[model samples]
Target: MKDKTIDYLLRATWIAVAKMYNEEASKKGSTMATGFALLNIDPEEGTPSTSLGPKMGMEATSLSRTLRSMEDKGLIVRKKNPEDGRSVLIQLTDFGKEMRIFSKQVVLKFDEAVHREINQEDLDTFSRVAQTIMDLINNKKIYKKQIPSK
Candidate 1:
């Protein structure tokens, strides 16, 4: 990692985390994207299909495919939104709820492990720094000027 840039470190760390989640998801006969969608969905009330893509930061086509796969796995069902006849709602099945709990536990275990290893002040600073980076990217501040390559 000598001479590595911040962007390089960010990408590497994210890839490692994603790989870990993917491996865990594979053991449960699911994918990380499905688990993420499950976690975002409301347990009691169904989530609107239209909003799922933005909520997951996923493209509509990708989300549609994942939702279809979940439906095929008997993990979820799509119902017409009663409030808005033009919209559809995505609701988790019993099995989906079970998987959601599994996803939650996986996240909690990772969080607990990190918490145990890092001091509160360090963790808080890391959180702030990460959020700052996200905010900068979201606001398009990081790419305002083109970089000169070596």
Candidate 2:
């Protein structure tokens, strides 16, 4: 397309960010997804397995696979939720806590860089625009259902 659309820019930016994160994570023998999951899980109080999926905006299958990999790497352990017998809690191992700190630093570094480069007003505008887009999608305002008359 000759003209770029909002989605194009959003997707391209996200892809670039993901690639940059993946590169940094690779040095630590991890992936962007793993780092993301680590950040989302509560350090003190473990998060529910079912909640992790919605919280991370990931599908169950993908989250399951990532959890499995983390488990294999000794990053996390699944324990029965004391309060909810039916649900499992995802708790970080000591090693997982260490990696979570690393992930947090990496994210903070990126945020610092962006703040240093962009002016506050521009950043605020960008944030507002992003939120508006999300609101539109979440509120189902983008596409309306059409009724066909017989």
Q: What TM-score, over all chains together, does every model reach?
A: 0.92, 0.96
Residue-level lDDT of model 1, residues 1-150, one tens digit each, is 789999899999999989999999999999889999999999889899998889899998999999999999999999999999999999999999999999988889889999999999999999999999999999999788679899
Clashes, model 2: 0
Task: For candidate 1, list the clashing residue pairs, or say none.
Answer: none
Q: State the lDDT at 104 in candidate 1.
A: 89
For residue 128, what is the lDDT in candidate 1? 99
lDDT of 2 at 79: 99
Top candidate (TM-score) = 2
Best by the lDDT measure? 2
Clashes of each: 0, 0
Residue 39 miss distance in model 1 (angstroms): 0.1
**42-81: candidate 2 lDDT, tens digit per residue:** 9999899989999999999999999999999999999999
Please report, in order, the local distance difference test score of every candidate based on alpha carbons: 0.94, 0.97
**Candidate 1 vs. true structure, TM-score:** 0.92
